[model samples]
Target: MTGRPTTASAVLPAALRAWLGLIAVLAALTAVVIGIQYAGHSEAGRADRWFIDPTADSVRGTWRNVALATDFWGEPAGAALLVVAAVAGCLLLRHRRGAVLVVVGAALAVVATTLVKSVVGRTIHGADNLSYPSGHTAFATALAVAVALIATGRLGLGRAAGLSLVLGAALVAGAVMGWAQVALSAHYPTDVLGGWCTALTVVPLTAWAVDRAADSRRSDRS
Candidate 1:
């Protein structure tokens, strides 16, 4: 697994900025989370009775089966740490970052989940905010994105055929876990949305930072 450069410092084009664009999308997602929380909680929000008619509540029964698929989603934080260790091993053994971004990004998702859960302090209702950031979704998306990047190449298979396969798998994995969260009533509709946002932001940041670090090492060598 040889890593390639994807940074300006590496003499690669700046098209990689698209990865950074994920940050902007994350900002918008945060705003949406706040909006939904406020809208669902405020007196004005209650008038609509959104909680009584939640998407997550309707499917709570199906979650047992879903849970089996992502029993590991609960353990994503640990898995993510394992990913980091694996990346480090790859670096040591093969001298490549290999999949550091995925591991780190997944680890970040675990952190983001804890932070949101702690700070939000919003409890779960028929389907409101008990789970603002679905760990299941976050880890699922994180692994999906990271694995895809790993499978492609240093440039991460910036090709359509390759990316589609990667993205498709990620979507399926993410969607399954996300839906499972809803079924279990562990989170709300917006909770999964927040998870997606968190994934988009953290995963790419991890990848870019990993790329930037690798590029820096190359420069030092030169």
Candidate 2:
């Protein structure tokens, strides 16, 4: 008897299957951003007024210098260098899967963020050009996830404490960038949240795909 034709869904890996919850969360967050934009609500404006206005003057002095430094870390060049360094480190350590995860995760996060921002058409604080998801926050969050994956995979830091330590540092760094974006009035709070959700969704999905690919290659070789 002839077999049924193969489909993408039929070949989906368990690893990817496990990440459906995260993907759902990302979708929900994206929906929230879109809904807010379409509803023509003033909630975002109110949030900006509450968060940005109070901090505007405060971020202008020494805080301005700090914000500038934080902003630099979130810049495209900085994010690229971070990913490059991470991938290089993974390669040096011979963690090929981890390296692949870092590269692919970063790329996916960037592309997803850009696409969502474009499609959602959400603006923040009068900026018409894509602001629903903060690019800086997304970059930082993706970099953090990549770094965490590398640390666990390469360094064998699989213990709960070790994982916590690595992940905690990354979270703190990402949080700082998100806070800076909000304080600088570059994004509303929802934008930062959406960016984080995007990263959380993309990185794990990319990691699952990387692992599945490696497994398939191994199976083929064997």
Candidate 3:
């Protein structure tokens, strides 16, 4: 006695298709950005210059001081801990499919970021540290993307209500990482860009697929 989709399932098809399209777009855009950076730095002494332009360097130093002085949620460890909490919350709420998607999206974000960074092998703007894809940025982007999906998808949140509030908090945290990295001279603008592209490209499609699967499971039992 299978039946029509539930309120949740009703929106799954269109949303899933949209998400897939978005992921493809995100991937393409990220690739293009990385390519542009590569070409930009391939010239005589350009990579060095772009990575450490004095103007940005000056601003970055000040940002790092703010992070150092406050230590208020600037640690990567704190971000990781939040990931654990997000996953736990989803599981507790019986949003298993969505939770899995969030975790997978995050893991894939890390993998993609690592591969791109390694291939670029570009150093920080002012230091020799690996900096093609800022690791802190990667974590923040991945975590934020995952949280956004949960906030707006299966968890059923309005942008101005409930989970959206939490999502906003997460966004702030994500911004903190990006700002800290840029200000502290830990990464260049391009490094943060790559991380965001990688995460945004994956999260939507992954969430959509999970939503579809969850709908199917419900249909099977009905």
Please say which candidate is ahead in TM-score: 1 or 2.
Answer: 2
lDDT of 2 by residue, 1-222 (tens): 122212211122232344444554665567466545633332365655655563344367888788888888778787778888888977786667777777788788878878877767777555465686777887888778667655554444434644464447557866898888876777777778777777777776676666667667666666
Model 3, residue 30: distance off in Å is 3.5
The TM-score that candidate 3 achieves is 0.68
Which 10-residue window in model 2 sums to the lowest lDDT?
1-10
Preferred candidate (lDDT higher): 1 or 2: 2
Please, what is the whole-model Cα lDDT of each candidate in the order they appear?
A: 0.59, 0.66, 0.58
lDDT for residue 187 in candidate 1, whole number 0-100: 63
Candidate 1 per-residue C-alpha lDDT over 1-222 given as tens digits, one digit per residue, 9 for 90 to 100:
234564222211234346345553664478356545743331213422454345323443455765654645457455656576656655653535554565577778768866776566545663334565666787777777666555555343444655575557667866787766666656665666667667766766676677778766777777
Per-candidate TM equals: 0.69, 0.77, 0.68
TM-score, candidate 2, is 0.77
Clashing pairs in 2: none
Model 1 TM-score?
A: 0.69
Model 2 regions lying over 4 Å from their true place: 1-50, 54-58, 125-127, 155-159, 162-170
Sort by lDDT, best first: what order? 2, 1, 3
Clashes of each: 1, 0, 2
